[model samples]
Target: MNTPELGWFKSSYSSAQGDDCVEVAVTEQSVHVRDSKDVTRRPFTMDLNGWAQFVTSLGSN
Candidate 1:
């Protein structure tokens, strides 16, 4: 998707502190993720199921 089509959401953990973090967006077809520190950088995309697993893993970390 193009930059304008993305609806980014910064992780609450990232916003709580000023440190470097990542942002994530759940798109219609896939999940879009990017560095919270750099909006212009390329983002990583993953399928819905992959995103779910990734989040599940994060909770365990």
Candidate 2:
């Protein structure tokens, strides 16, 4: 994906200390996730439905 044009943002829950930082970019069709500390690494992508399922599962746990 052409990441440069994406509006990547860190979670509001992330700490100012910068540890465990994750960045996410949402598009109409997919959601992009990556480590904020290492933008050079490839990001993980999932369809919007899958992303919603993942978030829902997190709440269940």
Candidate 3:
């Protein structure tokens, strides 16, 4: 994926000190996720429906 063109943003739950930072970018068809601390790492992508289910599951915990 062309990550540089995506508007990536850090998770709201990210620490101020930059530890455990996760960044995400959303597009029409997929959701991109990556470690904010290491941009060189390849991000994982999931379909929008799958992403929605994953987020919903998080809220249940």
Candidate 4:
């Protein structure tokens, strides 16, 4: 299946210098994650539940 085009946004925590930048796009079924500095690479896809868990886990660190 073709991935849907989404409006990706850079994380607010990303550096102003543009290094280690992370971008995310939300869709109906999943969230797409990619490196802002390397858009040519395939993105990592996660379901809503997985995405929630991942974000929650990050908050605990």
- Residue 41 of model 2, lDDT score: 84
* lDDT head-to-head 2 vs 3, winner: 2
Number of the predicted model whose lDDT against the real structure is largest = 2
Give me the candidate number with maximum TM-score.
2
lDDT of each: 0.79, 0.89, 0.88, 0.84
Query: Candidate 4: minimum summed lDDT over ten consecutive residues — where?
Result: 1-10
Model 4 spans with C-alpha error above 4 angstroms:
1-4, 17-19
Between prediction 2 and prediction 3, the one with superior TM-score is 2
> Against the hidden reference, what TM-scores do the models get?
0.72, 0.86, 0.82, 0.78
lDDT of 1 by residue, 1-61 (tens): 3365688777676657645887777778899888766778789989999988988999999
Off by over 4 Å in 1: 16-19
User: Which sections of candidate 2 miss by over 4 Å?
Assistant: 17-19
Let me know the TM-score candidate 2 reaches against the reference structure. 0.86
Q: Rate residue 48 of model 3 by lDDT.
A: 100
Lowest lDDT sum, 10 consecutive residues, model 2, at: 1-10
lDDT of 2 by residue, 1-61 (tens): 3487888888889998876899999999999999877788889999999999999999999
> Against the correct fold, how does model 4 do in TM-score?
0.78
Across 21-43, the per-residue lDDT of candidate 4 in tens digits comes to: 88889989999988877788889
Q: Residue 47 of candidate 4: its Cα lDDT?
A: 100
Residue-level lDDT for 60 in candidate 3: 100
Q: Itemize residue pairs with steric clashes in candidate 4.
A: none
Candidate 4's displacement at residue 46, Å, is 0.5
| Residue 49 local lDDT, model 3 | 100
